[model samples]
Target: MSAFDEFAAVHETHIGVVFLVGERAYKLKKPVNLEFVDFSTPQRRLAACRREVELNRRLSPDVYLGVSEVSDVDGGPADYLVVMRRMPEDRRLSTLVKEGEDVSEVVDRLARMIAAFHSTAARGEEISAEGGRDAIRQRWCDSFDQVRQVGVLDGDLTAEIERLTLDFLAGREPMFRRRIAAGRVLDGHGDLLTDDVFCLDDGPRVLDCLEFDDRLRWLDGLDDIAFLAMDLERLGATESARRLLDRYAEFAADPAPASLRHHYIAYRAFVRAKVACLRATQGDAASRRTAREYADLALRHLRAGRPRLIMVGGLPGTGKSTVAGLVADELGAVLLSTDRLRKELAGRSPRESAAAEYQRGIYAPEHTERTYGELLRRASELLAEGETVVLDASWIRADDRTEAERTAARAHSEVVALRCVAPAEVAAQRMRERHGDVSDADPRIAAAMSRDVDSWPSASDIDTSGTPARSLAQALRVLVD
Candidate 1:
């Protein structure tokens, strides 16, 4: 413990030890097995220390001094270490964000820096296989499984995250295949968060590339930047995060969808959440709170990705509104129901029943069109403010769905339609059980609507005749997938 008086400050991680001396820093690999990496022997530690110095020099060239030895004065080999010139703590990217300094210019520069690195990063068959479609899926499953099996977070939250992630991986097969085929995967800094960066006067020097395992650093370039963006947002620099993405896209001429950005951000957020929970298990009380906070942040990222418009529709009494409400709560979305909006438009309460016959009186053809138009109008407004919206109605007409698509296009958002269906008997039973809810559709009305509600192959289908839990799960899969 009394190694040197020049460096009294020291920090120990699971696999490495760092000592901050005057104007210098020394890092030593722990003689232990981390399951991910092993430094249990002198020769292994020497190799790892050399690798750390070499990998980190790519980003922090000036900071990494060289390798050193922990041998006795008698020329006996004891251990190995990586040496570095210490950087000013105040110049760290995280410190600047904490001080509320304007770092927009540097943040932009950081994006370009990463873009250049990713453009020239090594990519071969072996590297691609490490980040291949199946490997990436397993990586996600393994990460969430770590958190899931440990029972660190809430059970409901764990279940929700698992369902959403599983759906994204299962349904977005083409997205992953295209990226892999395009050679978007590369060896990158596995941990590129803000804290690992220094905003020097020359530029930004990113430090601490994942040195434990080379496979861990093999990644999709977008995923690499995503971890940084997520960290920037976590530090309350949301505008900086947005700027980084915008600048990176311009620099790289990327054509990936807005959905992919959201996907990566959500994935990064969850990864950080898992990290925080792991820290809590190591007996960090503050980290326990941070774990929950990160979990919520991940949910938000998963919810609204570029202001999508989700259309939930079917014949009346098929549980469209019920399922829509469940989705809204899951995504923290703005749900617009025709039954509620129609009453509001008529200067009546949402709970009030308008005893009009099907396709007659206030329920006439023109009224239906106007009601849908207003719903679309409101959805556009919310989307403009960066809000996801759910439209609940019996969209039995082909023109109705087309109109919704047009509205989403004009608002620069994508449309996902979820068509609910149930047997005639189940539909009639649900209608009979309804009392003071918003919708006023009766069993007879449902029969009338079902006659016209032809199948639309474009929309995802959700059979709602099962238990509510099963129906809600199906609805979530449709929305995410």
Candidate 2:
């Protein structure tokens, strides 16, 4: 069952082998049933070849020629092959990136092309189900089991990554539902590695999608794009990887949070790591190292995407609320203010006048404890579901700060304590000028609070005596550094 006497080159992967002859490439499915794919029979292989061509033509129409039947000497069909126009070996996106080429324009065009493709890709109830939180959790659990079974990666690290990934998914059910409602789930190119993308003179030709499993192909658009973004970062093109996501978000008008982007990227990396583990099991020694590298990348992205509890506290009129709002905007975190939560918990409006002396009436020790307790309770719930939170309150008591720390610890989150400060006169003036705000503190109350304020050595002091922008900058630096 041979047409060509000699092949120019042969490239072999776990699933199939490609024979390059002249200007055409022929792909033959290996007669083996793997965990993720099946090509163990002639009939199945033929169907797979046909599916590959039909699905791939959506992106690379000119390159995918058609499925060909390889016959025996009796002219009876013996095997099947995916025949196509061979792309230039030197023109792959991976090759160009390795050569340090300035591929900014090419990356931009590719992002737009993928965005346009996703804009029209299939989307319905069935496909949207694949983008749900449960679907994502299943895939992650599958990868974890496979990786653990292989016994190649470090067990402790694997567990940590697994916990972080699940925690991220736990808090994002609403976000995932929003994506489904907005039609972000689609049947897309599931295998979007850079090596499969050919950067040609005309534009780019993206090929070699996961054709064996339709379930795998049905995913959120962000998950589809993340495969390539993960590959790009692995290739050391971190900036290009970032730009691609940014441009794609702009083109698609995707209102995804940064945490979601990082989470998806981490998921892609873990999937590749799973593949590498499989390769290692097949006796590919170098794949073992690759598996570790991918696992590490996955861990890095997960940590970057983990939820945080940012505590912005100081005496009243030191601009704690203002700084907390800015930090929340910067990190896309939920902002919780004592003033707002206290009012909501009680039977009062946020702007209703509740002017009272410090630690009295609505601001009593018992009532204040309830407000902070409620804030921590709400924050713990959000953090459990992978949401970052910034709490704005006068953290004058060490007991309250300790409680916040304990809450963060329970959620496996980092706590950033920021103590906002201003000149005494500035604070007094701000309190004096307070009008329709939720805060009931006046200059006299501010002075009383300052005297009662406990020592807070752990928190970074953000001086609010200057402009709001300056205070925000200081707080952000503390968060970053």
Candidate 3:
């Protein structure tokens, strides 16, 4: 008997038929109708099924057995199924989260795995600016349509949401356009949720990528990160979201895109809520209730405004990034650093941009003006959208710190200046030992630093020369208070 003939068959409401072979499992796409996806034809479904197998191999090579054609005696294709090495049914991340299991090890491992995957995935052919804008607009339209079909939402509430969606998209159009122009879109796993992740003795195995269309899988990396973060929040694991993000940043060769985390997180939440509402409209009573709960959870996070803006100012190697990252993690805010921004603006890595001429370009009076201006602009936008922004920079100039304060005031938020102070000799020593850092400041730059550097902001000051955890704890308390 063939493997399919001997195995027990199962059915999945959303996808298709599944069969459990002795040591392997097979999933076959079913002919179905839904608003966002369709697998109605054998040829179309088989192609997508094959793509799924290939895409999933990027992250879970051990589990994706391969794709095989079901044949009727003569070895010609009859139907198709994706074969996978079987995993324990209870090993899903969603199950672990629900059971209140210790998942820190698993979560951290998966974060590093995803970071590696993003680094290797092929970049899509550059999209036209107009095309990018139209795609985003269509996403909003689909969201509205999905919400309306549920028929459970109040008319006034629906209209209010629709208005907010439009206004938010309109406000962020420029930044969206910039990302598209910069070629930030790459092939990514489309359906990234806890259910699709399985934990193994070695590490996490991610499976079931959206493979029907390249367009769905190809998107900005920020969008991909946001999906996982939003899902974590919906599952009531806010702290896990922070840890995952921090791990991603630490492992990635390139830093996380500056100040874009808040916007992407909100956008992902909106998408998740809309999809859940759409499913609730067509699902059974039990499933409908579950979907409503997910939608409601996402909405709650979206309405929670950004955390307050806090800047860590000092000379090079003064522990600014370390303290800022810790505070941002504790407060569940995005950490935006000048070091990352300077390199991104120059379109090169820190090492490449560190040439003498480039160094002058980076710190020139005009360049400094532009850099700080962009940082404040991004910080204000994220805060207004309901996210806390942590600005990390060597605010060696009184004028630059003043501009940041002004920006916070205009956003109807206060700025908490975290001044990191250390002995000049100690700062120089630390800078000398640094290597492969994205920050432009080096040991030679520190030698020129004067004790007459700018006056400290009339805010909190922490001496990072001692234990950093203690300093960070104090800063976090101020943020929470």
Highest lDDT, which number? 2
Top-scoring candidate (TM-score): 2
List model 3 lDDT by residue over 1-481, tens digit each.
Answer: 2423444546576668777767688898887756657888888778778778888888887788788888978978788889999766678888888888878888799788887888777775542332264676787677778677777555565565555445445444555666655655678887788888888788888887877666777777666766787677667777887687778777764343333554456567666656656656666455455545554544444334334678887778888888888888877677888777776776777565453433376766677678888898889887654456889988878888888878776654557888887887878888888777777677666555544377774867778887879878877766556
The better-scoring model by lDDT among 2 and 3 is 2
**Model 2, span 185-213: residue lDDT tens:** 99999999999999888999999888899
Report the C-alpha displacement of residue 434, candidate 2, in angstroms.
9.5
Name the TM-score of candidate 1.
0.66
TM-scores of the candidates are 0.66, 0.82, 0.62
lDDT of 3 at 30: 81
When sorted by lDDT, best at the front, the candidate numbers are 2, 1, 3
Q: Tens digit of lDDT per residue, candidate 1, span 422-477?
A: 99888888889888878888988877776877567788888998877888899887
Off by over 4 Å in 2: 1-7, 317-322, 329-387, 395-415, 421-442, 451-481
